[model samples]
Target chain A: MSGVKQRVPQIILTVVALLLIASAFVARPEGGSAPLGPRLLAIADQEFATWFSILAVFAFLMGGLNLVATHLAKIRERGPDRFYSLVTLVSFLVVLVIGTAKLGGPPGLQGDVTAPGSWLTAVFDAVLSPLHATLYSLLAFYIASASYRAFRARSLESSLLLGSALVVLLGRIPAGRHLTAWIPEPLAFLRVEELSLWILRVPNTAGQRALMIGIALGVIALAVRMIAGVEKDPRSGGDGS
Target chain B: MSGWFAPGTWNIALVGAFVCAVIVFSVIRSRRGAMVAVRPLPPLLALDRAVADAVAGGRPVYFVAGSQDLDNMQTVAALAVLRPLARKVAEAGGRLFVPTNRSLVMDNAREICRRAYLDAGRADLWRDDWVAYISDDHLGFVARVDGLIARERPGLCVLMGFFASESLLLAEGGHHVGAVQIAGTASAVQLPFLVASCDHVLLGEELFAAGASLEGDAARLGSLRGQDLCKLAAAACLVAGSLVATLADVTGAQPWLFLRDAFLNVFRAG
Candidate 1:
């Protein structure tokens, strides 16, 4: 009975999927009211997708609870990371309360959570915005470090990759174009700008297309497996019979 | 307004039906003791070894799903990979920690882990908190994953799904922690970054197949083979279309032009 019950959700999900797949063929009007089947399909797809968002929004409450629980447990245990957990819990509560109560509303406009000159915007502008920027800026340093490691010419392939990367990088900038201005039109394709475009449109695009096609097929296969009841777990297909 | 079929998507529907039919037929054949050949994926093979080693050493394995909501296919693909991975961990008597950026992904990961543990007959080893939602902010999620890598020092990091600019950041963070990193994504721009930084990468469709291929189900494997046939047909179409287009351009030939248009119309026509 328990096993049968466990399969119930999966079964329903599969049935819904099959219906959607079938309904996708139904023709819908472009500028006017669609036929019943097509209209129903469109509505179903929209409703299902929206339900995912709604569920996720409700799941946010669970996340908050989990965060609080995890941090509180850490504090209770007095682990070495207890200080961090304490800080996290305290900050989380502060933000939750402030955001929930609309405490940042203007003095005369207490109802508007996002009122102009509100503390929420102030905190966002003065604190979180800068923090977001700081984290984004860290990417520059990381890219440089990663590039340095990747560009090391330790092998034939590595050397080719490094050389190609240098050409592409140089070709993209104005300085590289200026340096190649003296080159003749007959050899214009060898110029940095032309070479960069060729690499991007030709080899790069070719490789990307191969990957894209493979991924498309794989996703299709996954869907097929799901519909066939081979993939039982609607989330991950973890259970194999 | 009276029609039931979508005029614009008729071709797509037909293709989908054909593919689904092929998959179903393949599944039936597979169940009848027919052998289905699947090519070996080096990264997935390495994944098996890494999980076993990490478990034997009593080190935790971290699963980082893509930083996207349920709207993204990459997140779903990542969930697929988690199923087998969680089971592997449960069977090995090790812990699997999953930190997701989206609430839905967190729930999905938690359910996946629970199912894996239950399937392995070690449901007691699974913890409700094993999967946690870190943040919805993309960069914020990456920052949290970086912190987790630094603190937990997981023996292995499987970064799979749809990733963007933060792909290298996460891979590099795992690299800095000396963890064996296996990453996969369908993002063309991020593929090179992951390939360069991670120990192994499931390029493109490989990520999607990674999860499907985990259990070696005949239906899944057969569908994979069917997809290969579709790919070949697509490749042939591309080559033929390009040839006809080039001939028309070079010769000003009306026949080649008509052929090219006809071929394109099949795919693009409503």
Candidate 2:
């Protein structure tokens, strides 16, 4: 009985996966076409999509609850980081209350939580947006530091990387264009801008495309393993069958 | 026929079916004791060293499953890699912390770590607080992680999954704290940032392959082999297509053009 019970979920998963794959391949019936199979598959696909959206809402709720619980525990422990936890809880509750009550909007639950003058909108625009922007701006400094370390011509690969990066960076500016303006028309292809464009369009694109293809193949293999029930469920934690 | 297979998608269906068949066959062969070997990934080795260092240093190991939800395949791959790492941390008697942006992922991550500890006979060391649900806001999550890294000063930081701009922040934060960092993602745009900042980085499909290699399971290894075969086939097609297209462009031959289009049509959507 226990074995049977365990197999049931696997069976359901396999069936659902197969059905979804079939649905994706089979076209829906057109006007006045009475194919029952394709129509049924299409409906199943739509239903699954709907179910997923519903599940996503619940997942967010669960996440919100977990966040609350975690912060509460931290506050109760009076740890060194309890102050940060308290700030997070306060921020979360303020946003949640303002958004739920539709405060400072048209004054009803039906009003938009993000209406221009609403408290939620103000919080988002005045606080959250600036914070997001500030954090994003930090990437510039991080990039400079990372580039300093990576662009050092220590080896053959690093030399190539440094050379190409130099060309690409310099090629984008007016100085690079002026530097190469003395070259004859016949040798224009060797100009910095042209070289940079060729590098980006040819080798860079080719490498990116090859990587994408490899990633796609990997995804397919993983999906096949999952649909075939060969993958060990992390929840089960079994030495894979 | 149109109703049987969607327009512009039949080619995809054919490819999908072929790939699925190949993977399934390989998996069956593996289950039947066929030998499969995976090339060593340095990032995974670095991950092992990181765990050992954390254990020796008595500092926690932090695993960041980038700011992506469970629906993303990259996130799934991240979780796959996490299972083995968690098990290692558990057996080594080292602390492991996972901060996630998605609740669903947080739940799954907690389960994986719990099972790992249980399997290692260290369930008592597993704490619910180990996997915390961070904020859903992108930068907010990064800020919290930055703070965690600064405060805790973890010895090892393993980042795997889909990341956007925050990839740099997380990696740089780890770098500043002198943590041994191993990062992996299939996102091509983010790969350069990680490679530059991380101690070791897994490029593209290597992230997926890392998970399979770490599992050391025949079935997953077989699937990895099958994926390689598909990549070879794809490369052949690309070379052939490029050659035919180039010849058509140079020669202005009708037959060459026809052949090129015919070949390209097999892969193109309607």
Candidate 3:
């Protein structure tokens, strides 16, 4: 574990050096206009981006290692949920080996890991994809349950929330139009569909845009803080986790 | 060698200037601890009361840190938020239940909770049983989370993170359990479910801004101001673009074309 951890700092320093060097030379200049330093930096940045992506891959491997260690320890200790640990480890190793080994090689060794008609592909498509989709779809049921309890018409704000929810909900459905169809063309602006559009487009969009502005600022601040290496941590500053 | 005016060189220079200005602005602002104006949610207070009740009622505070791994900005912001929240929960003598979808997230959540408890002077309240790592299988995580919400019947459920479809599910379950549900996520796609279900929904960037807003740290607030400046720049560009278009419409001079070209120059390919 220490051996594995040692590589991270080295990698970080290498990446910083690469980025700094590359920042000098940018990318291909229009009209063959790039100066030597900028051109070199641009090229370096491209190479850096290409190579640095591997860090994510390594992190994934690290995740797998952590998973293996934890689960194995769980199984050994006969922990309260040892069976689940075994299940996690089995699933992880199965995915790892199959994905990497390209079991059956799909259409022989030359094929991509996820090539169509392959076992790996099948497992992912049949198992992983639907599994992900199913988990994602759970939101639908959750929304229904959460909304029923939270959206009670208790007070003014709650009532307003209910009203907005209704507008947004009705606007998303055809029934909004079915009910509001009697309104004349001139007065159609008051229709649920139109109102929904206004709510999403005006207030929602405006609000989203405003938040984006704030987020961008926060990111900049975070980046600056990280670069300057501020040691403050809300948690005990050890590890800054 | 191409002169500084060469399109590529000029664009880089412009970007450099922009970056430098932002950096300078942020550096200065971070040093001057400033408070940002944040809209207080009266409903959020109601939410706190509801959560307190749930805890008093012997239910847990079910918190989901979204499905994202730690690297995501939304996740980091979520962690920042969880600090204060975990503190508040501990201070209230409530049990905080965090069921994470990712193993790394699970570890981080535990560390965060540990720190929070320590900070709140209730380190003893922290327990391994509280922060559990469910399966990474997204659906499995949701099912397990859903089950916990049902079984534990937490007094308050807070789901904050970079969620996808699971946002609706988690919030809904919390609501069903009669927990005070306050949810926040930066993912626009999941906002509908959250907006519909959660008692207090922090919209879009507010999720990021709220952490800084709540902390009232000058550096964070300055960053907020920097973002405002960035937005101003964007708005200025939009207004300028519109004005040029309007003038071009009247004068038949196509002023917008030049403005567009200028904008492109700023954003032009390397």
Candidate 4:
């Protein structure tokens, strides 16, 4: 009985999905004059997608509670770390209360607490966005360090990589173009700017396309497996045996 | 409902049908007990060792399932790997800590871990704390993992799936704590961060392969056979198309140019 229960949903859902996909090819009936199958599939697709969006909203609220539970645990631990936890929770509550209660603005227009001039918006604009920007700025230093480690010249490949890196780096900035301005027009292709742009348009694009293709194939394989019921029976958590 | 069929997606539908045909063929052959060969991924090899090491030393294994909610495909596919890993850890009497930022993901992880432990006949080892929610904020999750890494000093760190800017920071933190790190992702932009910082890195498609192979089901693994065959066909097309275009460029031949366009038309969107 349990096995049947698991397999039934999987089979039905797969059929419904395949139907929806097939519906994309069937031309819509004009003025509801024909083709019941295509119309039903279209309805199923829209309804299912709307249902998914509703579920996502609920999940977002659940995620908020999850964050609260985690930080509350840290506060209960009673240590120096508790200070950070308290800060996070207090900040969360202040925003929640102010936003929910609509303390600043007129009532019933309470949603999107990050609206203009609200306290939540003020905190976001003055404090949180700046902090996010600060964190993003740290990535520049991290990128430099990572580039240093990656571009070190220790082997034949590394030497070529380092050379390529130097060219690309010099080509991107105006100072680099100025440094190579003395190169004759006859050998203009050797200029850092042209070389860098060529590298970006040619080799870099080629590599990116290859990666994108591979990812596409991987996704196709996964999607096919899902449609074929090959991965697992989601309910039983096994092959529908 | 915007009527029945949507235009401008026929190319995708055609490609999907081709892939589905290939998959159906492969699945049938696989079910008949034909061999579906898969190359061993080096990073996944390291994964086994790291898990074993964690078991031996009685240290915990930490898995970062990225910052995405449960809706993300990477997170969902990653559970294929997490389930088996949970089973292994349970059998070995060691612990696995999975920090999820989404409540739904946490719930899914708990169910997967529970089922895995039950399959391994170690259901007693399963605990809700094994997989729990942290915070949804990207940096918030990274900070929590950093503290966990610094304190627990896990024997193994598996960071995989969809990762964004926090990829390098969290991987570097794991490295700072001196754990054997194995990172995998299909995020093209974040691949280098994992490669530069981790002990072993699974680039792009290799992550999917790792998850499938760990599942140990031939029918599931057979999907890779179809993917490989499609890739081979794609490679042939690329080589042929490029040669035709080159010929057109060199000889300035109208016929060659016409052939090149014909080849390109197969892939071009309408």
Against the native chain B, each candidate's TM-score is 0.90, 0.96, 0.85, 0.93
Alpha carbon lDDT of residue B153, candidate 1? Answer: 85
Taking the tens digit of each residue's C-alpha lDDT, what string does model 3 give over A1-241? 6545544654574567546534654444545555666665566667766765676466555555666676787799997668877877888778778877787665456778877766798887888788778677655566566577558898897797789879989989987779898899999999999999999899888777766655655555554444443312434322343
Per-candidate local distance difference test: 0.79, 0.89, 0.69, 0.78
The TM-scores, chain A only, for the candidates as listed are 0.88, 0.94, 0.78, 0.83
| Candidate 3 lDDT by residue in tens digits, B1-270 | 443233366676665457546755764766775444545644345555765787678777877888887667777667777777787788888899887766667777787788888877888888865776666566777876887678777888777878866677677777777777888777877886887777788776667665666556566566666655666776787678767767766777655677666776775556
* Stretches of model 1 off by over 4 angstroms after superposition: A19-34, A106-112, A234-241, B56-58, B118-125, B250-255
Docking class for model 4 is acceptable
Cα lDDT of model 1 by residue, A11-119, tens digit: 8868888777766676544555655667677788778778877887798877777778877887999988798788778868877777676775844434776777766
lDDT of 1 by residue, B136-227 (tens): 77887788778878988888999989888889889888889888899988888888788788888988888877876777776667767777
Instruction: Judging by lDDT against the true structure, name the best candidate.
Output: 2
**TM-scores of the models, in the order given:** 0.91, 0.96, 0.71, 0.89
List, residue by residue over A189-232, the lDDT tens digit for candidate 4.
99999999898899889988888777788877876777667777
Which window of ten consecutive residues has the lowest lDDT sum in model 3 chain B? B1-10
Candidate 1 residue pairs in backbone clash = A26-B4, A26-B5, A26-B6, A27-B4, A27-B5, A27-B6, A215-B205
Q: Which candidate number has the best TM-score? A: 2
User: Per-residue lDDT for B51-80 in model 4, tens only?
Assistant: 888889878998888778655767766766
lDDT of 3 at B100: 76
Q: Of the candidates shown, which would achieve the greatest DockQ relative to the real structure? A: 2
After superposition, which runs of candidate 2 have C-alpha atoms over 4 Å from their true positions?
Answer: A1-5, A32-34, B249-258
